[model samples]
Target: MVSLSGSWLANGGGIWMLAAFYGATAAYGIHVGDRSSEVVESTRDVGDAAANFAGFKISTVNLSGQNHVSPGEILATAGVKPTSSLPFLDAEAARMRLEEMAWIKRATVQKFYPDRLDIQVVERQGYALWQKDGKINVIARDGTVIAPYSDDPRYVKLPIVVGEGAEAHVVEIVEALDLVPGVRDQVRAAIRVADRRWTLKLRNGIDVRLPETGLDGALASLAVFDRDKSLLSRDITVVDLRLADRVTVRLSDAAYEARQADLKARAKAKKGSNT
Candidate 1:
């Protein structure tokens, strides 16, 4: 019985040796195969396949810090496919791809050993709408264009800025308007004139030409006028606030004609009374 047990142990050792040899040969063959053919598959894909076979397949992706961007977009951008493996994933490269998206301000990626990945992203917030050369886009607070206008309600109510160089300087006017919500709320758009000054177009179809300097005081005065005298509700087409001392108003065609006729009638009545 002892001799029989010894023979069995020897045969078991031989079987283990043969298994080791086969494993080494298989690994070397895979290495040679990866180097030999470019058309067969990329090195990354081969590594991913081997890693997956070794029980390192990516089974879970923990994503966070995303709102405007979707999970699918993040996964696609990071190249995390159905067959991706954690052992072969490039975290830094995936981060760069995520940041390439307009909505993503910054991104981070991490791979967990065996079967998990963690992706975090900070998304750009839509600050306003900028229109130039007949095209409109959603812009971030720092003036980066987030995307083209798609009538998304999330950005539809934002203040519209038009003209050249508006996107880069929109924050200035937006902050200025924010100080005076009385004027800001009534504004439909802010047009950048000659890339130097701003002209506020009110919702009531009134164009207010603002001075290049003392913008805050001008907006404040406009707010006062709207608050006290309901100036914005008047039948005026334009309000020129370029001059520091006075506000010049241009009436609509109908209002202008009516005012002219009323002035003429008052003058005739005064002349007849004097006679």
Candidate 2:
């Protein structure tokens, strides 16, 4: 006989149930023609009893695709120790906390009925080692810092970049080196010089100075020079390609001594011819 008519648009099982119960109790009070302030208290008790009877306590939490960070670490960061009832647990809040971790890129939290939670995490993958101020850290492709670098075999194959603001320019350097296939293997590290140009440290203790602008063209010319003259194999300490047109070479001590000797002998012969 209770007809308290109005729109009650509630969604989700828990929310709908709670709203419907409260609404039904209010309507029933009007039909009973008696003041029943105890309806609210009674409904709350029944709701608590139903939630407990449904086995809504969180007991098991399953995490998938979590490799770099252990579940214990996630649980600690999430601040969501189990034994919390599923009906009142804030899943999105827990997920936000998990995403705050550096290793975790994204996270999805799913509530399984009764007593379990399933969490799927996407961890960041390191693209290179960033060496700055003599310290190394692992960096992702998008230049996000993953962790401090140690000599891990898992990331041994990745390129190592050095100097200030090197992470931001890693992709540029790698792509330019890719264009110059001959120069890639000889390069041991790509170091940012004054945060402008790149100085590539070669495997044999030589440095190749690349210009700041028009890097692709410079690399192309270097690649051509390497192909024609085997320029990389020369006993040189530095190859300065910072200039627009010409390349300047700084020879190793042995190579410099040999060149000086040849020059001195040619000068002596020219003086004798003049006499």
Candidate 3:
């Protein structure tokens, strides 16, 4: 042991030694940088095993929020297999893949640690069939085209609309038809023409040509005429409701000739009876 304190040289030497100790302590750091690198390399090996699907299990798969798509189909789309490893699973990538499907509007994917995957889906709502280039396809209310020619039978009764801008105008046509009593039942299909006018093909094979303006009024008038005079029952081929005050009916050639002859004969008979 050294002599007691209060000696100038001893005090000066002790201060220098303390300063050297603090400097060494400051230089030393608690770092796992090398250890982290080794751990990452190990995880990489595990990821390779997972990619090869070796010694892994999918304990739980929770699927929800699906309406049109099945869980199996979703799994197939995600490219996920039961034996796939946790390190190799990409939940976000799987979600993106599932969202690409036609019926899937949105999707969410979550991973619960230790071996569970949770999948959620939002499905698109199909509204009408859009007829384009002579082929009919289903569409959403916002005019997004869904599947083509799906014989799903659930959409069998949905109204089919045709022509340019038909997808945008189909809703309006349906609404207008609602205003006319029995019109919806009688209408087989509605074709929106180039001039923005509509030609309704009736179930009886008759065509009701509506005017560009006042279409609802014309439809209502035709409905009333159909009910009272059985206009639809006649053998007329087309009913042109373009005129404001009067309806111009274009009957079949034979029916027109027969009507004219009957009218003339009735007039002659009435004149003779009065005389």
RMSD of each: 9.8, 10.8, 17.3
Global lDDT of model 3? 0.72
Residue 136 deviation, candidate 3, in Å?
A: 2.7
- Candidate 2 C-alpha lDDT tens digits along 1-275: 11112222222357655565455445544543554548643543444334433445455677788889987887667644433445544579789999989899999988877666778889999988999877888998778889998778888878889999899988999888888778998889999999998999999998999998999998898888889999999999999999988999999999999999999999999999999
lDDT of 3 by residue, 132-211 (tens): 79899887776677778677887887787888888887777777898875878888888888838889889888898888
Best by TM-score: 1
**Which ten residues in a row are the worst by lDDT in model 1?**
1-10
How well does candidate 2 match the true structure in TM-score terms?
Answer: 0.77
Which of the predicted structures, 1 or 2, would earn the higher TM-score when compared with the native? 1
The per-model lDDT (C-alpha) reads: 0.82, 0.77, 0.72
Q: Candidate 2 — what's its lDDT?
A: 0.77
Residue 175 in model 1: lDDT: 94
- Please provide TM-scores, in order, for all candidate models, with all chains considered together: 0.79, 0.77, 0.65
A best-first ranking of the candidates according to their TM-score comes to 1, 2, 3
Where model 1 places Cα greater than 4 Å from the true spot, the runs are 1-41
